[model samples]
Target: MAEYKMTTPLTDEDVEKLKIGDIVYLSGTIYTARDAAHKRLVDLINEGKELPFDLKGSVIYFVGPTPPKPGEPIGSAGPTTSYRMDSYSPILIKHGQKGMIGKGKRSEEVKEACKKYKAVYFGATGGAGALIAKRIKKAEVIAYPELGPEAIRKLEVEDFPVTVVNDCYGGDLYEEGRKKWAKA
Candidate 1:
């Protein structure tokens, strides 16, 4: 129930304290990776090739942003639906990815991986592109630029707001939140 201020470096304790409905303004380093990047990463793993960056304790944001306006660090950046990358997530979780940022439902196996690995999934408000883009301080494409929107980019962010959709303990906000409205 604690309201965290913007720009806090969330610890394991801080992340663990967050629940489905709780809001947070995330800061610090986050890496962007989507379906194409994920596929490449997994392929690298299979080939025993080194990845572009260390996966440990990193947060992978599932986003493909629009081109930035003049002098802006990034453009309309927001989370995409998570289910598209469900098959790749469990592997990343097993490899030490601690947080995922996206929207919509995930597969049961991904949820199970979160429980087993002390990982979490966060949901950014869908369609809040302009508002979300303001939080990004800088953007650097680290891998797969050919994929364009699906490319992996490293972002330095400040006060990025999001809701806890899934936590390490098997709590799911979307499921519980929907049930309340569904019973109407």
Candidate 2:
């Protein structure tokens, strides 16, 4: 419905302003994590241990990138199916995480958490890993290196394209779009 250009470490105000179906180009630091990394992060949280990165106002991208070739900050980097992180997302949102970047549907709990916490869920173009990789300006493994591609990485991205799939106001583009098309 609208377009926005946002930077990472997104504040509550930044996320609250977004609406489902709005296009977004994100530029700033985002952390990468997939299933394994998410589990570890949640485990750490439960143990009251220090996390590798600060969660406050942060955006997490659900991706496990391919190994880079020479002179590239990252390789094919695409969003993974978001549901895999559903079990852990609400907890992260509660900890001050303001945004999530991934693809596909999320659970009810995750959606409620977004609304309750003033966070948003963004959907990256699936199957566009190579194109998305180009937007990443820098990447460094921040934790769980043994997991290889699944390792948590800190990434600096520039104008990385995405769309708002869910917003703080309880909007869900996937559901809304489906209903719209179903009625047509």
Winning candidate number (TM-score) = 2
Show pairs that collide, candidate 2.
none
The global C-alpha lDDT for each of the candidates, from Candidate 1 onward, is 0.86, 0.94
Please provide, for model 2 over 41-106, each residue's C-alpha lDDT reduced to its tens digit, 9 standing for 90 to 100.
Answer: 999999999999999999999998999999989999999999999999999999989999999999
Q: Which of the numbered candidates is closest to the native, going by highest lDDT?
A: 2
Give the range where candidate 2 is weakest over 10 consecutive residues by summed lDDT: 175-184
RMSD of each: 1.8, 0.9
How many angstroms is residue 175 displaced in model 1 relative to the true structure, after the best TM-score fit? 0.9
Q: What's the true lDDT of residue 183 in model 1?
A: 58
Q: What value of lDDT does candidate 1 attain over all alpha carbons?
A: 0.86
lDDT of 1 by residue, 87-147 (tens): 9999988887888999999999999998888888999988998989988999999899899
